[model samples]
Target chain A: MSVELVDVAGLDLEAEADRVSARIDDFFTSLLQPPGDSRDQLYAAMRHAAIGGGKRLRPLLTLAAARLFGIDEDQALRIAAAIEAIHVYSLIHDDLPSMDDDDLRRGKPTVHKAFSEATAVLAGDSLHALAFEILAHEATHRDPHVRSELVLELSRASGPNGMAGGQMMDLAAEGQPLDLDAVTRLQQLKTGALIEYAVEAPCIVTRLARDARTPYRGYARNIGLAFQITDDLIDFAGDEAAAGKRTGKDAGKGKATFVSLVGPDRARQQARVLVEQAIDHLSDHGEEADMLRAIARFAIERDR
Target chain B: MSVELVDVAGLDLEAEADRVSARIDDFFTSLLQPPGDSRDQLYAAMRHAAIGGGKRLRPLLTLAAARLFGIDEDQALRIAAAIEAIHVYSLIHDDLPSMDDDDLRRGKPTVHKAFSEATAVLAGDSLHALAFEILAHEATHRDPHVRSELVLELSRASGPNGMAGGQMMDLAAEGQPLDLDAVTRLQQLKTGALIEYAVEAPCIVTRLARDARTPYRGYARNIGLAFQITDDLIDFAGDEAAAGKRTGKDAGKGKATFVSLVGPDRARQQARVLVEQAIDHLSDHGEEADMLRAIARFAIERDR
Candidate 1:
């Protein structure tokens, strides 16, 4: 039986997720076709890393948010693809021997393992470069200012002050006793920033004034925290086989997650609270925003 | 007895170079000041990698190119800083254990050595993100189109089909024999793309018609090739003390290079020829283009 949130119970995200994944795959295929040159290996590695697998949660969030503003599907697709590209690049780098050293990603051998370490490094860097390239492409928006804003918004979300900063903190905090507030801050930066960007990017495309983004930002922020909390909950008590990659890694490494500071039950309870609060942020909108409300309720459903 | 290109004789680049370096240092310091947070380590790592080192060749190239178009100095400086940030980020990643695995860079411990490998990786990724962020920042250019173009050009220069692809070739070519054509193609991507962008980017800022960029593109391509030839020549015969990093790695690794294919004398001669051709591309410009001419001549002067 499929679990569903009460208010968003009728929302069928699977079909939408499949569509987003298919669109992203098509984008990658078009962008990364074989070069018939030595660099073809680089493209191959990029394809293996990005082409398939993983729930299209982040991109779906982007699309869902775009639906709120009735953004052009093609423009929304680029934004979604750019965000997913960044997420994929991060995964490639995170799996390198110098970092998390995971042998598997998306249930396949990581890029470094399948290709080589040097190739993996370059592949990750290339994809990181591709994110900005995609956003800056003229086709992303008719207005150059919108494209520029997308680049700026995305760069800040992924850069030193956001995801990277949070990652640094995560590395430093290992084996250290961190309080709930500290952990929350770390989570906010590590994963919340990108999720927030995914939700707010539609506003950029729609040319909605910056001040009007408050409710949307609030909705994204709450869901981002809720998503991370759910991820931590899964890592704490979830099964290894079901999770694909290793589960219980947090407890194994003695990392301080939401579940470590508070019991799993309290953590799950807090995630539900966050989801409810997230849905409340969209009260100003009607049926057009139902997908966003659905996304908030289903944020914790990211099993992958 | 300093070496100087004969055609561009008496051009004093030292004073200008110093100014550019100081400006870049100041920009980095302003952007990456101590955050009074755990991310201070990341900021410190970024500062270490970017501040007070190298010839600032990429940024200086950007400034020199901008001079041809009479772009604003502050705008030129942002363009310069953005290019330098990409260069610095590449260097940081190039020194990673999974990539070039170098212990030293610019006579200091590589970021991975001074900081953790994880920190170095994150710092590199952050700086890569920063390049686009800087370019997309409104202060970089008043026109959004210019800023967007800057992001596109810079990202394309560094992405999979450019520097990263070339790097992949270099990795694959190690221990295998290669000829002049293969090495040229590799170096063009590995080092040539960014240099080309450095010189061509000014045209993007000025909104020069795409066709109008042909001469500048030719100039950049010639100097870019010349620059790599000079680099291989230096790597063949230069000193570690003067270079501030390990030298002779190409020979040590049996990697094919211009020197390997053409011998040192021929490589130097070829580099000089390229410099002259690079200068020839600016036949349309007058005294205002003197600095660009000087930079082309000095493209082979990057000892560190």
Candidate 2:
């Protein structure tokens, strides 16, 4: 009863995202149950932060990439869940009082606001640990070598030299005069690393060699930058009610963003160009990659 | 040339600790260098928390356990450094304002105190990611299976079901009275899980089978409790200067500790008895386990 690739033509990515989001919610529901009564509250906090909100874009990227290889759905879902865990954990920590100091996330109280700051911190830490645990588990992959590679790549992407490093740059950049190159590097590290992982992880799971991955890698990189550019555009001009969060935050903080460095017209033009280039990398694939192409278009077109 | 077992008899465990501590320092110095200049400050914050002033007991435990399997010293040092990273990362987060709120750690300013609260969070989070990064690298172990197992064990020990769960319990227990059973469970999940991993990681590196690991498991469980009991005892009556942190904190907070529940004399006696029992678990290894036995004694006798 496998799903047919032909049916995916003219794919509505927003609907596909909602479908994967439902799967992701079920996945988190199963995994977040506290082991014992003592930890019920901690698990609850994790569930609250992770289960209900966000675009689930990273996981969707994983699923879309996995479709290119005909990877097992169950296995791909597990990897997607792991990637989402890392994404949510970063959000939980980023929203803390000491970090971005946000009281609201996705239209509700942030983890630290709903729970205590200490619980929020532990929940974030635990979710980070859970990401690695899922990747290393035997259930994630049959080959130990594949699992090790996944673990290595994800850890490197998230560690001091990767996502965390990018985050440090972001925090330090607030109200500082960062050049366009510096801001690009910061965005690449902050959000681009995980996006790269999402696109590349399925390759690892499918045992694709380095030379064979150039197209996928190129596609991921271009789309990642495009995604960020659109994010900046949304922050600059989108409605708060439509975006589900504060708007014009980059301008408010006087932070350098794509929309700030370039005029809105130029930024939008660049995002459209990048999205077209990203889609060009998928020309080798047919209907199997239709969702990826649709998502590339959606990257620039979406309001949120 | 390798040191002989006969030379390690009547070992100056403190000197051995210092030797391993130096190795751990060198390891962090190499890994914490930022790949690009952008993340130098985050790397700096991680170095500030990890490199200086602590007992380094967990790493010592790893090195000691590796000795029993005749593992390569270089390999053992890498694993030990990874364990130390996790320990230090935990301490960094534990001392944050949202947690224990300690300004001083090891007689120096806590990471949050020395750096900004934001840096402290990133440093700790980055360190946690770094631990798994070290373990998954090919240099940690040649066998991918061994590396995967090491990653799985470490992640499980640190995740929601283990260290984080215990942390949740600790926060919830701050103002409430917990029974001895509750406290014991908390300590087991908090510190005991990692201690067990420290003892057992070498077995994975050596490919030691399940049945052969019973004694090591027994030894680690007993000594882990003994170590926590001794910590409570130190907090009860040790000198602030010698311990390198504030003393009498548990009592001041009116929190229940081993000393508070069992009385000073009985808690001391209990720790000694547990340490002796822990040593007995290593009897089968004869001279090969001398360091393990010595460490059991040291767990109770150390002031900090």
**Candidate with maximal lDDT:** 2
lDDT by residue (tens digit), candidate 1, A10-51:
445666778889998999889889788888898999999999
| Candidate 1's DockQ | 0.84
Candidate 2 lDDT by residue in tens digits, B1-304: 1355424543668688889889999899988886667577788888888896798888888889998989998998888888888889999999999899999998989999888899999999999998988999999999999999999999999988788888888887876868888888899899999998899999989999979988887889899999999988777776444556554777566678888888889998988898878888888786667778778878886766
Mind giving the per-residue lDDT tens digits that candidate 1 earns over B113-228?
99988899899999999989999999999899999999998899999878888888888887896899998888888888998898888999899999999999989889888878
Please give the CA lDDT of all the candidate structures: 0.86, 0.87
lDDT (Cα, tens digit) per residue for candidate 2, span A1-304: 1244323533567688989999999999999987766688889889999898999999999999999999998899999999899989999999998888899999989989998899899999999999999999999998989999999999888877678888999888888858889988888888899998999999999999989988998898889999999998877776444556554777667689988888889999999999889989999988789888877877887887
Cα error, candidate 2, residue B151 (Å): 0.5
Give iRMSD, candidate 1: 0.8
In model 1, what lDDT does residue B29 have? Answer: 91
lDDT of 2 at A8: 50
lDDT of 2: 0.87
TM-score of each: 0.94, 0.94
